[model samples]
Target: MKDRKSARTKETIVRAARKIFSEHAYHTASIRMIGKEAGIEHPLINYYFPSKAELFDAIIREICEEFAASAGEWFDAIREREITEGFTEFIELLMEFNRHNPEPLRILALNLTQTKDFSLIPGYHRFPDLISRLHTLYVEKIKPMGPDQEIRMFLHSFYFLIISFLGAGPCIAQVQGMDPDGEPYREWMKATLLFIFLPRLKDINLPRAAAREDG
Candidate 1:
């Protein structure tokens, strides 16, 4: 019972911290603000998290873990089988992840736009593995043209596509008289991303034989 209570308290603190961080960005967000948002005393927050930096680190870890798990599942699913036209479904899964986790996405946008110090964010330790896993998956699916750099560019483009749309938010969409969170816009983004990537996928060089493999 005590452990459960503690867990709940920590979860509440995290929820409040995510909202405050999204609204104020990391540097501007304060412990007092998070405490108030969580309906807990500021000291309670300090008891759970030693400092604002630690709290922010916790959030980053949580976000990274969630993304790693989701992406890992998709990676495992396509390990043996080719992605082929399953790219559409993959894109939709990414969109769905962002849709359900807008707060974390907003927090990430703040980190990207305001600080840009990715080192401060947690979960990057898994990045090398994530990239390696993705390389294997893409190598199987696209059978890329040249070297790892070509594959790296493709992966970077995929990252940018997801970030660009998620970072836009309602404010950016409103400028164009569109709703970023709406299903119509999501479908449009999905289609646009697919249109941009499908040709590249199709144009990629076929897989080299075991003797000529460059990966």
Candidate 2:
């Protein structure tokens, strides 16, 4: 009973911390605010987490673990065939997750822009291995005529573009002269993704004249 109670308390604290950190970011969010949100005393946060950095690391680790577990299940289901479709489904899942939990996405953006200190997070260490495994899965699925590097670059660029588009929603809207409000924005985004992935999309011919001159 005592261990169960402790687990509940820890979960409550972590949930509260995630909410607060998502809004105020890692450096700006105080333990007092987190404890208040968690409905516990301020010092209780210290009792549970030794320091602010430790708490932040714990939150990131939890998120990464959850993502890994969820991805593993999805990957297992689609391991046999049609790898491109599986990859597309995975991207859609990530997009839906970001749309639902915009706060965590915001927190991630802040962390990337402000902090270079990813060494404290265990997830950072495992991320490369995870990427490599995912790439191998893709290679097995799509027996492309191009080199492995070419295929990897194509897939990586596609997902990276998706992430950047979602992550910089405000800036993209501003640059594109579109309103960042309501159903129209969502529709526009859906259309944009469709256009990018359409089989009939045309390629732009770069100025080979310049390359020839340089050569």
Best by lDDT: 1
lDDT scores of the candidates, listed in order: 0.71, 0.62
Write one digit per residue (lDDT tens) for candidate 2, span 1-215. 99999899989999998888767756678999999999999798788888887888788766656655555665565544343454456556666766776655455545555566766442355445545655665545433444567556665565456545665566676677776444566567766665665332111111222333466
User: Number of the top candidate by TM-score?
Assistant: 1
* Residue 161 lDDT in candidate 1: 60
Model 2 misplacement above 4 A: 73-91, 116-130, 136-146, 167-183, 197-215
At residue 70, give the lDDT of candidate 1: 82
Superposed Cα deviation of residue 186, candidate 2 (Å): 3.4
lDDT of 1 by residue, 76-104 (tens): 55444333445677777787888878776
